[model samples]
Target: MSAAADPAAATGPRALAHPGREEIRIEDVLHALADPVRLRIVRRLSGAGEGQACSRFDLPVSKSTSTHHFRVLRESGVIHQIYRGTAKVSCLRQEDLDALFPGLLDSVLRAADHQARRLGEDGHVQRTDG
Candidate 1:
């Protein structure tokens, strides 16, 4: 059988979500992180405790892109998604991260930001105090 069709292959690194995790939308996570804008949003979100709203992030991308990024993040397990009226609130899955592997998300985001800044990318600021 093709690896995709094999249960054993399905249990590889890509299958390593939390024990009870419903399949985390891989496309969502990849699409979300694919954009420079969305990656910055995630970097900022990681510095916060939980639940940052849509308006709080200052993305240079257009509103449409912003919405798309949020949608991707929601579909991904990286962030918890919620709609509060017209505003969509997103928060890092802290408990989920701790359960899955400690410090992975924060370290990744921080390292990404640091690398981006070192390379002179403009969006790589320390997350602003909200």
Candidate 2:
């Protein structure tokens, strides 16, 4: 059926495309998490219990650049995004990821935390609780 003709699609905000869990490849996920900006986004989302609005992040990059990062994360199956009213909300696909590649997310998050402390960036330590 046409998306417009579907009841859920008619009432809900426009849907964003995401790879099915089975289609999520490890290479794409690793590549997406490789970028510092994208890794930061993932780390932030991991700590947030609920989906966070895109604007809630205070990334040190141009708005367009931030948008590109989010798009990469979404396309890589690292996170899921949905439009809510005028805002877009994002959250990690933790369960799917954990099931697909056990301990992968946790390992990456730990590494990020280590690097953050090692670099002494702001001297502020953040927890990677997911």
Candidate 3:
């Protein structure tokens, strides 16, 4: 089987590249999270609190586009990706980020959640915040 087809082979250290905690830069993280799709991914990962397979997300974008978003997040150190039985699973780098930025991730997620609640998923105003 191809490497991608064999999770065992793909689980090696070189399977994916992620910046170290010290290497993660605030600007890169912010840029990665700036995209709506990537931010949505992060929000879901935050809520899951566990590794989520890439295919599990119901992203509106095409598969290639979603992959690109994931790459951006991973490269920027906002998330970590690993292969699990022929599936790429992703989890937020919450601990690393918290240690490095001290509440930066939580703040962004909270603000995003509040905005989503206020605007609804369609981006149209649903209700005004009291």
Candidate 1: give the clashing pairs.
Answer: none
Top-scoring candidate (TM-score): 3
Each candidate's clash count: 0, 0, 0
Better of 2 and 3 by lDDT: 3
Instruction: Report per-prediction Cα RMSD to one decimal.
Output: 10.9, 6.5, 5.6
On a 0 to 1 TM-score scale, where does candidate 2 land against the true structure? 0.83
Residues 1-65 of candidate 1 have per-residue lDDT tens digits of 22122355235333422212346544555566677777788888877766788898888888898
Task: Give per-model TM-scores.
Answer: 0.64, 0.83, 0.87
| Whole-model lDDT per candidate | 0.63, 0.85, 0.86
Instruction: Please write out the lDDT profile of model 3 over residues 107-130, one tens digit for every residue.
Output: 999999999998887899985555
Residue 62 CA error for candidate 3 (Å)? 0.7
Judge candidate 3 against the unseen true structure and give its global Cα lDDT, from 0 to 1: 0.86
Q: In model 2, what lDDT does residue 42 have?
A: 97
Clashing pairs in 2: none
Which run of 10 residues does model 3 get worst, by summed lDDT?
Answer: 1-10
